[model samples]
Target: MTDLKPRKMDFGFDDADVPFLWNPENPAWSSMSNAVSFLAVGFEKMIVKLIRQAKPLMTDPAVAEEAVAFMRQEGHHSTAHRQHVAALIRRYPGLQNTLDAVIGEYDLLTEATSINYRLAYTADLEATFTPVFKLMLDNEETLFRPGDDRVASLFLWHFVEEVEHRSSALILYKAVVGSELYRMRMAPSVFAHVLKVIRIACAGFNQHVPLGERKVDALSMFARHRAKQRVLTFFAPYLSKGPMPRAFDGLPIGEQLTALKGAALSQTPGHDPAHENLPVLADEWFRRYDAGDDCTRWYTAEPAASGANR
Candidate 1:
């Protein structure tokens, strides 16, 4: 009875000319989300392998079922994101190197880390998605609606499915590893690695993607990078990356702070993702999908009439 069913989606990323600045109105957000596409391919690939290895350790039948469903969902996500990244690489061939570096980081983690540690890593990261994705989805009017439909729809589908199975990773971790303290203790290192991978992808974007196309510093998603760039602008202008802008600058500060607080709280010892405030769009997206509204072209497709149900 696991509700974590995997939904396969093809966003037509193969159609020509997938721009790096997918969301022209929010170039910084475009850059950040593109980096996420790169990150997802590698991270989810690791998840597939991690789940396979951890499968034997799962004792309860329900936990095993949840783990398999979670693995399938993550597998679909990785495939879809690869299509997105492949389109980007086709446009900017040097992005191949960036993709390789990102995947290599995860490959190394799988080889170097223990199963318990990897479980902790997955649990820690997955716990934050509901809050972070909610912030993005809640403001989809600006963040997603104004973007290229294919890319936006791809993310919309992915985020909703993520919400659907928000607790699976932690559930598997608790079942197999059975240590909340260990997960909490490993949060710092886990997040450090996550940020490091994102930094690598963003740095590659800056080096490979032209400034005119990217529109802002690729590393602008990182607050520390932005602060350093600000200092460098006055002292050593040439050393700085291009102008640093935030992806969420247009979003209300209070909402951004709330999401930040939620993300921080997610790493605590006993946080439960099921209790977190969800994005309104998640329910809407599900309603639309169940109503056959063609979520792969979310913006272009007509929504079902009001009061419509599956």
Candidate 2:
């Protein structure tokens, strides 16, 4: 069984200062990416709650155990993003108000919704995010190669773990309430909600960017257009053809981590999450991280320079 237990990965965000556009070279991409992190701060708590609600319904011990691990990881993810959101609001003048409004709406949804709806939404969103992360990881060089080390490391760590446990929610959801009709029905709304939040957050991020960088931002936006396309491609099969029987039959955690680098690239039919591969640097980052090297340097292109400055 996959050891779904979450690792105590304290990336030390409390002390680090980060730039508003951490990926300074590509403000557009930075805005979209940061917006996702921003959303996670609030929504991941909902993920944990939904997973917890579903875990009790899981009869399979393996699925139940993985749910426990998923809950821990999601809790850690939410805490990290909450820390980043605080720092982000400090950096950008109006972001807090925007975030507060979003959180307020989210709180209302959580209060009014059933556990089934929440679980289905969480599962769909997890599936959605996994592919987007894959695209970012695959194109890490041109996209994120030049960025603030602390900020980049924060995101890299998050995405690495995201790929690691991408299937947890879906597996539990299926085991609890395996309804193809319900899954298909909820997917569109889930993706729509996710896109709405991203759009709002990205708009705020762009508004804060300097006018001089708008042209560069526009070009970067065009370059990342493929990411949006990949999102559709990733979910299209499930939406149209129905969710795969083994879609959530994910590999063990050990195999999943080992397969991530390649999985990001191909994601062969039978083996997902495990079948995909990450970008060269990202793969190496995980290698160092797994090996217990000072992999925090994975955040920056120049480890020595980053260390000296720190």
Candidate 3:
């Protein structure tokens, strides 16, 4: 095995200046999806802070630093997505009610637990998000990785950042509880809430959109943009991989179990940005949902498949 090297952590970046958004012509329903993602992330940042303090007591200083870096990247994401959602809200005035619905779920999630529970939440979240994180990069590889320009740069910007600080919460969880059980136990909890929010936002998709003279059809909207291809391409790598990544890796189980299948997946076999719940602000659609989740228990122990497929 290659020796694990401590990675440098930094939140400082030019992406701070990147325009708050893209895909401006995207439908209002898309904005709602963005809002949900942003909301999930914003809430998760709180949990990030919790894990940092716990990390040092359990692991080495290097791990603590990584936790902070992970938190910072998530923080940056939160700010960017917040701005993205605000811009969309401005453009589509009538989308307020559905926007509130997404936020409402976020509120409920926030109020659901204590700091410890929240830490448990991130531990759970890591189980949920880690795989998706990998899949996102895998999907982007065709478009972004292995290139020389800034565009390619941004792909790893998110990905390298993901790799560099991936273990923050997991290390802490081992120190605190020292359990292999954290990974499995937390997955369902995280999925339940996340799925609920997604279901509401997806269903409310049409309500947020503005149709001039014609209403948007969900099926047609999904078909228009190579959405199916994007999904299948990214997920194919996951399905084809010979064995599951061990839970010890701090990879989210969500990455393992889903291509976003039941986390409220919708097929717009014929959709496009203008008529679908496609993310208007992809950044926002991804970040704002984790409200103080805790992943401290995620990386502590190996799974039963000893050294199988890591």
Candidate 4:
């Protein structure tokens, strides 16, 4: 049994992650959904980076098999997410510049080729995403809300996948670069972004969108799905992921990843949506995402015909 466990499952985004497509019903959601395309461009880059790193580490035949599975799942995740972002782009034409700018920033950062910089970038991203997952775990029931299902699926699936492979890159980072400061730097940034995205999305927006506007009460919606709870929920188990000062045993990154992946596979559900979908989304993902059998092409997104549809 692998020592690694699947982190708590959760939805990462709040009402802000969901867009209303210009429906006067909830403007913040629309803004959030649209603005998130910029967020996802960075997320996609991170996905690609992990893929590149995983390639060489996957030398052992069995470990290599797991690495391939991880790739496929991530590829599907990126594809599904990009498609969802495409939906948002169709609705908010103005988001193009935002998406491009974020991508450009990634290009600029990666051009330098500093592993520290890349690790920092990865840390920042993990920090950014932590809250979204935290939220999903905190409010497992709220995620089933009728209107938010699609957006919840988007955020939650990503959230779960993050936890499923939570230890992989961190282990890899430590293996390649030998930096504990990286972990310290990453922990704080993770807390920061998770808090900010929620505060702005839920609290700030709720003040603007009144209660009488929708079928369901908007305030309750905000309260139930806020990011604070989500973030906390995710970090709970890791409170003991290691002793207060983690034991530095010099474990091989590949072996640790394989163990974690194997454990995750035991816990998670089937990968293909066509098959019986798994109940635990992220664990399943981290386990089988890289399976060579499932990897597919990620296409450049094109705008939908109507701004209202996305």
Candidate 5:
């Protein structure tokens, strides 16, 4: 049986006044995570279409089942993220253009790319989530706890679920395409496209959101951007993006390096996401969720208040 379960969540993004800087303590993290919300919507929309196209080609019953469940999960994620993005757009209407542009990139890819190439793209990107999400989940106290409860809870649910089905995309890819070399060959382009989408979202943030609200450059998450900004500050201040701060400067450098190494290894041949180290928070989140905790308000929910709906 497929272990992936699609959990429906309403983060009350519409009811509350969602701030652009949701985590005032870490505006850069808030900005970066907002970009992630934008990326998730477009990327998961592509996943839904990709899986639908691949469904008929899936000969193995198990792989078919996994694909169906994975598709359902991703569909729910896309819906939830759309809500988040809608809230942001309600606040900053110009972001609608940004969302359209991001989705347009994936739409173009679907039209231009082959099924095998799309499968490889999905597999290559999803394989890195186990390690990348672990680094964030492991430091949830700093990365999530201080953020707006709704936004923080949204990411907590999303990341844990990403970890839960970490291997699904690769399994589907291997079942259909079955070319490790092809997957590896596609990694660079897949990641480049991902980064490009993120850049679009960040640049939109800078253009649409005022510096007084965002407090730092939206592109601060990129190390290369920071390096370039540092040189510009010394040489050409007029061309610099304002106040390049990192989303993860508080995180341990070793943990960050480990995540980077793990991400690199994930693209190589014969890498199994099932064998990757998991975050302790994923297990705890599952336990709480299974126990009927109100995960939509992860921090405020009382654990002792049992029998609440998931």
Candidate 6:
């Protein structure tokens, strides 16, 4: 993993003209993903604030700077997702109301919950999402093959950064609470809540797709099966009190950031997020992203329609 400061590369989600079911071949995947984007808008904001709250507690300047960089990346993420969601609202009409309610729910939680609880929630959620993103990265070609490029690129970029900053919350947790046991204890509740939110989001997304399209088919069925296996592989160890295996070491660095517990930060005595040189694939991708090259065509601008509805 590279230790460079996070850069805010806005992928212009506003101008993109994407269908409601961007992945025409797999509306289920598209719906679930849309739900995630809806969650991102508010959830990321809460995470950014939570990270900033831990700034004073961070003694290492490098970690502190990473926190700041993480905030910027998350801020841009929220902005891009918010724009995409607004477009969805325009296309689906009723989506705005559903998402508004969800954001409002987060608002209430933020207001009533203690900071430590919020931080714990953020950390656990990050841990939960780390493996999920790894799965997506692992199966990108199959899942995204028929999806809209703009939407695919948006999520790809988001997941890449998700891998990039996988350790930020853990580092912050150590700085503030200094207890892995607390995190372990909090895991069940956090995972339960995360699942509930995803269910709600999927329900919202499902409403927008036609019933015929929502039916299960060979491709979607296979996708779901693979997705389940990846989830179990990532979480079974922790849940069963067994050894955690590093199943994602060979993935792209962007997806490998949280492969193990998390890439350790330089702020931590022996661990450095930038310890190993990045792989050629990731190093080149970041270079293109930084330079605003056409390699990011899917994200930099609106992409053409994905042929037709399935």
Clash totals for all candidate models: 0, 10, 44, 25, 0, 0
- Candidate 6 matches the true fold with a TM-score of 0.71
Candidate 2 stretches with Cα past 4 Å from truth are 206-283, 299-310
After superposition, candidate 1 runs with Cα above 4 Å error: 303-310
Question: In order, what lDDT does every prediction score?
Answer: 0.92, 0.62, 0.41, 0.42, 0.93, 0.61
Residue 8, model 2: Cα distance from true site in angstroms: 3.3
> What residue runs in model 3 are displaced by over 4 Å at the alpha carbon?
1-36, 48-60, 94-104, 128-130, 141-160, 211-310
In candidate 2, position 22 carries an lDDT of: 70
Q: State the local distance difference test value for candidate 4.
A: 0.42
User: Whole-model lDDT, candidate 3?
Assistant: 0.41
**Candidate 2 at residue 101, lDDT?**
62
Per-residue C-alpha lDDT of model 4 across residues 44-153, encoded as one tens digit per residue:
56556755764574444544444445455555555665565555445444444445555555565566546554654454444323334443333343332233555545
State candidate 3's TM-score.
Answer: 0.50
lDDT of 6 by residue, 1-310 (tens): 2264555555555676667667766555666677778889878878777776668877888778767777888888888788778888877777777787667767776788767777777766765445566556666665565677767777877777776777776666666776666666666776666655665655555465444543421122233534654577577733221222222223466654544334222222333332433333334445555554543344334322432111
Estimated TM-score for each candidate: 0.96, 0.73, 0.50, 0.48, 0.96, 0.71
Error of 4 at 30 (Å): 6.2
Q: Model 2 residue 132 lDDT? A: 60
Tell me which of candidates 1 and 2 scores higher on TM-score: 1
lDDT value, residue 60 of candidate 3 = 60
- Residue 130, model 1, lDDT: 93
State, as a TM-score between 0 and 1, how close model 2 is to the true structure: 0.73
lDDT score of residue 225 within candidate 2: 40
Worst lDDT run of 10 residues, candidate 4, spans 240-249
**All candidates: CA RMSD in angstroms?**
1.7, 10.6, 16.1, 15.0, 1.9, 9.8
What ordering of candidates by lDDT runs from best to worst? 5, 1, 2, 6, 4, 3
**TM-score of predicted structure 1:** 0.96
